[model samples]
Target: MSAKLYLYPGWLRLWHFSNAILCLILIVTGLSMQYTTQGDSMISFQLAVSLHNICGVIFVFNYVIYFIGNMVTTNGKFYWRNWGGFFKQAITQSRYYLYGNFKGESCPFQVNEEVKFNPLQKIAYVAIMYVMVPLVMLSGIAMLYPDIIIPELNGISGMFLTDLAHIISGFVISIFLLIHIYFCTFGTSATSNFKSIVSGYHD
Candidate 1:
């Protein structure tokens, strides 16, 4: 029998929704600023900058809450990698996604109280949350206060480097968001996982 479980708590729901909104805002404004010239932009360049910075600050605050919540709550357990047989588990999970699922085979990983993410998810989340997000935030901060927070190499200006880093990281995160959304649809139904985040239950 299929078991329904309380997978997402209220605080996590709040964080997830808030973060998603802020991310959407940031991505929109950021891309607007990057691609459009000042006079030809959809939103004014100044407005885009303002929106991006504001959303970025809010996103950082939300990220802090997410970090602290994970540290203090059971949610963190999902992210902790099981080093023992990690590669094997990851391979199995990858195979399921790439081949097994197409052949009508069952998934190798299942969600439960102690293990929320599969091996591949754990690795991807770790890299995204711990590495890419931090770098993006740091580079953004450097962009905001280029003089005070110089992140330069030998002779290159920190502002230029930081801008490049921020752009690349944001692109990577954007791609990840697409992939994440696609995978979320792979649940029991197309919207099951989406509904779970809203209602805090998973079946």
Candidate 2:
């Protein structure tokens, strides 16, 4: 008989679901923005920009809550225990994914509250939360400020920089989403992992 596992706390569930929605919106609006270039005005670029920005702002604010909650462990979590365990788990987990798991082998590490997030997950989420998120937000704000914030950004050079950064940020986020979807099936029950992110519990 399998035992119930309490993987997610309430705040993590709240953040995960809300963040997922924001990401979905960003993806759709981003696509819409590109679509306008082909003369398809069904989803106007201006409107998408506004929606994306507002959602981005909400996400950023919530992310701050995510950080503080982690610090307090009010949610019973931390990104990882320490640098050493993090690296060790990450490498072992990567090897598991590459070789062990495909052979129907057992996972190298069993998860619990303290050892949550296999190495690969830790690395991916850390990168997405730390790097990709900030990069996108910065580029988004820069785009918003091309006219008033900086003379360099308002002109051709600024436009090029902001567009390149924004597109690159979007590309990274898209890759993360695809990887996340593919890896979601790795849990004991196929849908349990996804459900945990929504409901705050895993059984």
Candidate 3:
């Protein structure tokens, strides 16, 4: 039998579930606004805009809770890493995903009580949560309040730049979420990690 670890707490699970729901809503609405021609959208333009704004605000608040939770909880420790030989460790993990796993070899970095994320996961999480999130939020806020952004940036519309940034960052986050779900299946069983997120235990 595989070992079990009580890694996820109640608050964390709530945050994860809520965040996932909010992100999905935002993705759908955002796509409707961006890609749909008037009268040809799955969601009406006005309704999509409203839903997108509401979910965006809620997501921002959820992210704030996540930030504070990380600050006060031991869970935050997993995101930090020693820079020494980090790339090599990430490469090993990559090899495991690309080749070793196909050969039925064990993972190079196993999840444990002290280490929840492997090297690549740590790197990806840090970039997404810290860099991309902030960029997207700031850009989104600027877009929401157009006056906050300079009227013209190098003769280009400031709102245009802000919107572009928000779209790109949001796209990156969406891609990350898909990959995250894919990786969740790499646990002991195909559903083990999904169960862990819900039950607060990692198998």
Candidate 4:
């Protein structure tokens, strides 16, 4: 029998759903802006820009909630790296995903309050949360006020660099979303992970 654990907190669920919705809005509007022509766009260029900016602002607030909540709660420990045997643990986890799991081997890591993530998950989440998300946020802000931070280098404006960074970061985050969804299916049931987030219980 699988054990049920109270893994998610109410605040986290709120922040998570908020972030997910905002991300969907941003992604749709962003792609529309990128590939849509003026006459046949799904959303008008102006409307897309407005929605992206609005959702981005809301996402910032949700991100702040997540960051602060983690810092103030024991949940923060979930992302911490134990330096001892870190590499070995990471390699084992990678092997489980790549080879062992296909052979019916059990996972090397299991979720608990103190150790919620495997080594590989810890690293990926840390990079995505602390590095990529922040980079994307800052770049998006910079794009809004190009006049204040304009630095021309080799005939390229700083605005171009900021936009490039924002686009690349968004793309990386989108890819992460796909991988994350795939892993969610590894739970006891296909929707187990998702249900855990919604109901605060993991089986």
Best by lDDT: 3
Against the reference, the lDDT scores of all candidates come to: 0.87, 0.77, 0.91, 0.86
Off by over 4 Å in 1: none
* Cα RMSD (angstroms) for every candidate in the order listed: 1.4, 2.8, 1.0, 1.4
Alpha carbon lDDT of residue 22, candidate 1?
Answer: 85
Output the lDDT of residue 12, model 1.
98
Instruction: Give the per-residue lDDT digits (tens) of candidate 4, residues 53-134.
Output: 8998888888899999999987787877465798899999999999999998988888865677888888888999999999
Give the C-alpha lDDT of model 4: 0.86
Clashing pairs in 1: none
The collision pairs in model 4 are: none
Q: Rank the candidates by lDDT, best first.
A: 3, 1, 4, 2
lDDT of 3 by residue, 1-203 (tens): 76679999999999999999999998999989999895667899999999998888888999999999998999899997455789899999999999999999998988888889989899999999999988988897787788899888789998888899999999999999999999999988899899999999998
Query: What count of clashes does model 4 give?
Result: 0
- Clash-forming residue pairs, model 2: none
Q: In each prediction, how many residue pairs overlap at the backbone (N, C-alpha, C within less than 3 A)?
A: 0, 0, 0, 0
Q: Best-fitting candidate, measured by TM-score?
A: 3
